[model samples]
Target: MKGKEILSAIKKDIDEHVGEKVLLKANSGRRKVMVREGILEKTYPNIFVIRVEGNDRTSRTISYSYSDILTQTVQLVFKNNNVAI
Candidate 1:
């Protein structure tokens, strides 16, 4: 699929899991990997956001471009053990 098509699909996938917990797996791009469990916050035209809370009780928002999903640079897992994006 083309970029726009893939982006649309990713957005739809995210929308489906709104208000649900998901696993976000991504490489920090510096040889380190980061994985977080958070609620699928919201989806935008260009990017989607996740709400992650650290052990210190600090909540942070992380956003990723749709391309990240398409390239598999980021993986999103639904609570049902299904891969969303």
Candidate 2:
């Protein structure tokens, strides 16, 4: 699926499971790594970001945490035809 689709899916999943635990996963990419890292950058204990990937293309997924964050669910806002923060 496209990045926007993936992000929307993630946002929905997060809202559906509030106050619970959730996991995010994606294929190998610099953007994926950045998202994982950003999620980990929590000042206080809240959410957790896990990286899950495989050596081969057939098995690879990067994950992001949504249940821990307190912000409202946001869609994958895009700018310049690319994923926007």
Candidate 3:
């Protein structure tokens, strides 16, 4: 697939999983990685959001563009099935 096609495919996959539990792994630079468990929230035309809760009972939303997934800068996996999207 071409770049636009691939991005669209990624967006479609995420759209199907909205409101589901997902595990997010992201590269935070300097050899550090950030991992979080969150519910897949909303998908805009350019980005998708995830709601992550902290140990202190706090929650925040993080959004990433579809290109991040295409470039492997971000990864998403379904919590229940352990399948990467």
Give the 10-residue window scoring lowest on summed lDDT in candidate 1.
Answer: 1-10
Candidate numbers sorted by lDDT from highest down: 3, 1, 2
In order of TM-score, best first, we have: 3, 1, 2
Per-residue lDDT over 1-85 for candidate 2, one digit per residue giving the tens place of the 0 to 100 score:
5754654655554344333222332333454422221121121122333332344534333333443222323222222233332
Q: 1-85, model 3: which lDDT tens digit per residue?
A: 5888889999998898888999999999999999999999899999999999999999999999999998899999998778897
lDDT of 3 at 67: 95
CA error at residue 32 for candidate 2, angstroms: 17
Estimate every model's Cα lDDT from 0 to 1.
0.85, 0.33, 0.93
Q: Which of the two candidates, 1 or 2, achieves a greater lDDT against the reference?
A: 1
Residue 29 accuracy (lDDT) in model 3? 93
Q: Name the regions of candidate 1 deviating beyond 4 angstroms.
A: none
RMSD, model 2, all Cα superposed?
12.8
lDDT of 1 by residue, 1-85 (tens): 5767878877887788888899889978888889999988888888888999999999999999888988889998888767666
Task: Supply the global lDDT for candidate 1.
Answer: 0.85
Alpha-carbon runs more than 4 Å astray in model 3: none
